[model samples]
Target: MWQFFHKLGSPKWFYGIATRFMPWLLASGLLLLVAGIVWGLAFAPKDYLQGNSYRIIFIHVPAAFLAQSIYIMMAFSAVVTLVWRMKLADVFVKAVAPVGLVFTFLSLFTGAVWGKPTWGTWWVWDARLTSMLILLFLYGGVIALDRAINDEKSAARAVAVLVLVGVVNIPIIKYSVDWWNTLHQPATFKLTEKPSMAVEMWVPLVLAILGLYLLFGWLACLRMKTEILIREQRTRWVRDLVLAGGK
Candidate 1:
């Protein structure tokens, strides 16, 4: 386990693994996403309450899930960066920040779009919504901090500390509906209990959620590979790879 963990810290090893798996990830993720969206939009029974507008959850739930999940993943990487001093960990933090930001923004945008008909408005200050907004800011802060610092190492350390601090918002985002009277509904899916939605309705959502997670993995690998090349440009391995490609 330690050996595998140590190997994961190697940029070259990760790049090679990612290269081999990237195509598979992309293919499977796309397949699942398309399947989920088509099935949900075309075949699944409409909500008796919200009607077709609830179909938007097919996209919104997955994007929202990815937004929060990516942050949690980043927080783990931040810990690894601070504790293990792994350059690859810092590379991951840098590479995935933009992706997280994009997903966070997507979630917020989609939520607003979904809200207009359901909530009778485009925006609200509800706890879940507010915390998610803060989450978006955290992603922006990480990206801004990374760009602001000239020194890579110093910037990584700063970002890691900031990530650890912002992690406190995650649980609040998770439990906001329960902790306070809020406009937001309870989680659409939960691990500890069966979903209240029908199997037909929720299966597509499950596919969507899984597909989005795989898609995030693929995107992270792509970004991390690019980051590794940039960071490792001075190394002999990188030089050899470049020279071979030139040949």
Candidate 2:
């Protein structure tokens, strides 16, 4: 296990592995996403109360889940980079930021859309909503910090430290609904209890979440490969690979 983890520290090896994995990940992600959309939008039974408005969960829940998960992933990568000085970890951090930001924005937008019909308002200062907005800013801040520094290593270290510090907000975001009386609904999916939703409703939601995770994985690998190529352009292996491709 330790050896496998250490091996992933190598940018060249990671780039090669990611190249091989990209096609399968991309295909699987697209399949799952399309299936989820079809099931959620058309086949799933309407909510007894919310009616068609509940269909927004197909987008809203998955994006919200990814928004938080990506930050945790970023923080974990930061820890790895700080503790082990792994360069590939730095790439992962940079690769994931923009994706996380986009997902966070999607979550917020879908939440607002879902809100108008259910909550009777499009916006609110609720704890869950506010924390999610802050998460988007956090992602943006990390991306900006990465671009601000002249030295890549210095920038990576700086953003790693910031990410570690900002990780405190993750738990706050997770428990916000439980801690406060908020307009936002409590968690829909829980591991310990049987899902409150019917099979038709829950299945599509689960599929959507899995699809988004796979899609994020595909994008992160692609972005990391791009970062590797850019940073390793002067290397003999990269040079040879590029020249060979021209043949």
Candidate 3:
């Protein structure tokens, strides 16, 4: 187990692994996403209360879940980078920041769109919403800070600290609806209990969530491979890879 963990820090090893699985992840993710969206939008039972407007949840919920999940992944990478000083860990952080940012923005935008019909407003200062906005800023900060610093090692350390600090907001976002009288509703899905909605309503959501997670995995792997190439350009493997036309 320790040997496997140590191998994970090797850029060459990780690059090879990522290359092998990236295509599979992309294909599976897209397949699931399309199946889920089509099923939910075209066939699933419409909400008796919100009607078709609630269809946005198919997109919104998945994006929101992935946005938070990506940040939590980054937080773990931050720890790995800081403790083990693993180059690949920092590489993961840099590669995924923009992806996280995109998903976070998607969640917020879809929330606003969903909110207009539900809450009668496009935006609100609700706790969950506010913390999610803060999470977006945190992602931007990570990316900005990484680019701002001239030294790669220093930048990794700095970003790691910032990520650890920002992690406090995650719990706040998760429990905000329960802790406060917010307009945002409670989670539609929970691991501990059965889903509240019918099988037809939730089955597609499960597929969507799984699809989005796989898509994020594909994106992260793609970016990490590119980052590995850039960082390892002077190394023999990268040189050989380039000479072989990036095969």
Candidate 4:
């Protein structure tokens, strides 16, 4: 297990592995997303309470899940970078941030849209809602901090520290609805308990969530590959790749 982890520390090895994995991830992710969306939109039964408006949850919940999952992943990577000084960990943190930001933004936007119909307002300061908003800002801040520093190693170190600190908000965002009185509803799915949703309703949601996670995996690979090429442009492997492409 430790050996496998150690192997992942090598940029060239990971880049080569990621190159092999990217096509499968991308192809399956796109197909699953298309199928999930079409199934949810066309076949899933309407919410008796929220009606068609609830359909937005198909997009919203998955985005929210990814928003939080990506943060935790970054925080873990930060720990790896800080303790082990792994360059690949920094690369993962940098590559994962923008995708997390987009998903966080999507979650907030979809929540607002979902809220307007349910709560008769576009915005609110309820605990869960406010915490999710803060999560978005945290993601944005990490990305900004990374780009703001001119020195790559310094920027990565700085971002890693910030990520470790900001990780506290992830659980806050997650449990806010449970811990406080809020307009936002409790989670539809849970790890320990049976899902509150019916089989038909949740099946597509499961697909959406899986598809989004795979999509993020695919995006992360693309971003990591781009970052690797940029950082390793003068390295032998990169030069060989370019030469191979030209042949």
**Best-matching candidate per lDDT:** 3
Candidate 3 TM-score versus the reference: 0.99
Instruction: Give the poorly placed runs of model 1, Cα more than 4 Å off.
Output: none
lDDT of 3 by residue, 69-156 (tens): 9999999999999999999999999999999999999999999999999889999998999999999999999999999999999999
Q: RMSD to native for every prediction? A: 1.3, 1.3, 0.7, 1.3
lDDT per prediction?
0.92, 0.91, 0.94, 0.89
All candidates: TM-score: 0.98, 0.97, 0.99, 0.97
lDDT of 1 at 104: 87
**lDDT accuracy of residue 135 in candidate 2:** 90
- How many angstroms is residue 153 displaced in model 4 relative to the true structure, after the best TM-score fit? 1.4
User: Whole-model lDDT, candidate 4?
Assistant: 0.89
Candidate 2 lDDT, tens digit per residue, 121-214?
9999989999988998999999999999989989999999999988888998889999999999888988788988899999999888899899
lDDT of 4 by residue, 1-247 (tens): 9999999999888888988888888888888888888888999999899988988988999999999999999999999998999988999899999999999899989989988988899998999888888888888999899999999989988999999999989888888988999989999899799999878888888888888888899899889888888898999988998889921
**Candidates ranked, most accurate by lDDT first:** 3, 1, 2, 4
Taking the candidates one at a time, how many backbone clashes does each contain?
A: 0, 0, 0, 0
Query: lDDT (0-100) at residue 226 of candidate 1?
Result: 90
